[model samples]
Target: MVLATPVYCKYYSKSVPYEPVRLQKTNLRFYLHDILSGPNPTAVPIVRPNQFGALVAIDDPLTEGPEITSKKIGNARGMYILASQGTDLTLVLYVDLGFTTGEFNGSSLSVLSRNPILENPREMAVVGGRGRFRQASGFITVKTQYLNTTTGDAVLEYNVEVVHP
Candidate 1:
């Protein structure tokens, strides 16, 4: 019998708000388990390098309210997954939201993964609704592990952008 375990990887955005409110590009890199050595027959080697992506949007609506006339915002997220030489594993990613408008407040969004099952065994989520109004900025993230059930480590890379008008 073989038992599988879960691995955790976290990505954080720059603490500064995307100024100039224009389309921009960013990159995020995550380091996995340390390298191994020696002639080990049962040792699993690292195969994947890292993941990368871009954020795209077109005049997307981000905020709307009686006080504010029309504050349209557009944004998209992209991700890349690296290859691995392990058995079966699970990866988890998390996102942190910062500050925004009242309309988006108290509203939650879901984060989808290429490999749904490998994302999270419990659920696929991003931002939370509760306590959103009080928070100036929040966080959001996605997670996924190698395709092996072995107990090893790996790396994760994330790249995003915020386009504005």
Candidate 2:
């Protein structure tokens, strides 16, 4: 499946915040095709642990993009994860230029720890019987960093697709 525009978040210090920072906007492109044949291809059908959420698998080939500036600042590290508002399970499919190497050379794709899943709010009640059905949503987040700087724009591209049983 094709991915949409990524959501960007900036990190700045209140004491000495960086100003006039413009992140170079880069588009990550890729697709995840279902593996129909393989030793355990069918067994790994992109399972979503949360019944109310969805499962997204990002292809490793497309993880290159821009890098966040000011990574030295506290919490300057940026991350991308999947999140959901309802009972649907949210799965982080792919992440752009947030790796150690800081390039989308197809290296950090196996880094699943960086991505996390978000669950629905339990305090709220379900409406329209939709409560029983939980789905998963695919999303990405870019946290505190200089995406666009004088050096250049670090653009990472990757692909993620949803699979359901």
Candidate 3:
């Protein structure tokens, strides 16, 4: 239900006033398995389809590779809004990604951005984080590696670089 909260919600985290004593940058490549058609789909449309203001809630698996059978290292959960009014497909995305089995085991990142979903490789902003990634800052580039129109399933490749403390 956190996704229901507005991006500009009244509740907020005051900015970190000081710089981290040491900053570390972590680069990772992963994939998101978006199953939007099966009986128990991970991503589902919550609003009128293909229309402006439409919303989609996502609880997709983040894997080590494009294959769904690959190692499941993390999870991506959030929502995106179809913000475009014309033919272009643009969305305002908000996601919280967390790793479960890798070096980033307990860390998580908060992301927010507006991107053209159809773009080959779209970038998003990393706003903050928790655990080892506290006070994080960076960007993530994503691409739709594979999509099954008939079943509404997709495999998305993600390249993330985060400077954190």
Candidate 4:
């Protein structure tokens, strides 16, 4: 006698925020400290040759503190491409961040950008958004500060401007 095996599968529909708030095109800046590795990491480090990806936690004061465990406003995921020779190498990035407490809690903003990687300061389009940032469209500025080359770690300063209503 043999026993039969059971298989289960599930699917979820596209997610959309409920009664999302709206805002006008405004400029916001923040510093993201990406730790390639540490004792405990809020965001894991991932890197590849053709493509590299990382989940970086937002740092509040531009300095390393206890933000990794608590007080983390939001997180960012960045993907990049390495070109043999070209003017455009950096692909794009998505930033999701907002207030951590009070009525503004849980109401986050998302920004989609497409900018060059090598450029010291470049502009990228803000494609989409969610939560309090619905119907968003604008641009973002990126600046890279190399911290550690061996571990492939660095700090990215982003200046976001968007309009939503």
Best lDDT goes to which candidate?
Answer: 3
lDDT of each: 0.29, 0.28, 0.89, 0.56
State in Å the error of residue 122, model 2.
27
- Per-residue alpha-carbon lDDT of candidate 2 for residues 15-126, written as tens digits (9 for 90 to 100): 7665653323222233212222345331132545553343433322122232323231111121223355454444333323222323332222222333322221111111
Model 4, span 73-145: residue lDDT tens: 4555443333234445555555555545443355555656555667888787776666666666787786776
The residue-by-residue lDDT of candidate 1 on 1-165, one tens digit each, is 999888797886778665553332222222122112234322232333432222211111222221113342211222223223343332333323222434444333323333333444233333332242221222223233332335332222222222112
Clashing pairs in 4: 25-162, 25-163, 90-117
Worst 10 residues of 4 by lDDT: 58-67
The backbone clash count of each candidate, in order, is 36, 29, 0, 3
Model 2 / residue 119 / CA error / Å:
22
Give the best candidate by TM-score. Answer: 3
Worst 10 residues of 2 by lDDT: 121-130
Tell me how many residue pairs clash in candidate 3: 0
Model 2 CA lDDT for position 126:
13
Error of 4 at 142 (Å): 1.5
Q: What order do you get sorting by TM-score, best first?
A: 3, 4, 2, 1
Q: State each model's C-alpha RMSD to the native.
A: 20.4, 21.3, 7.8, 7.3
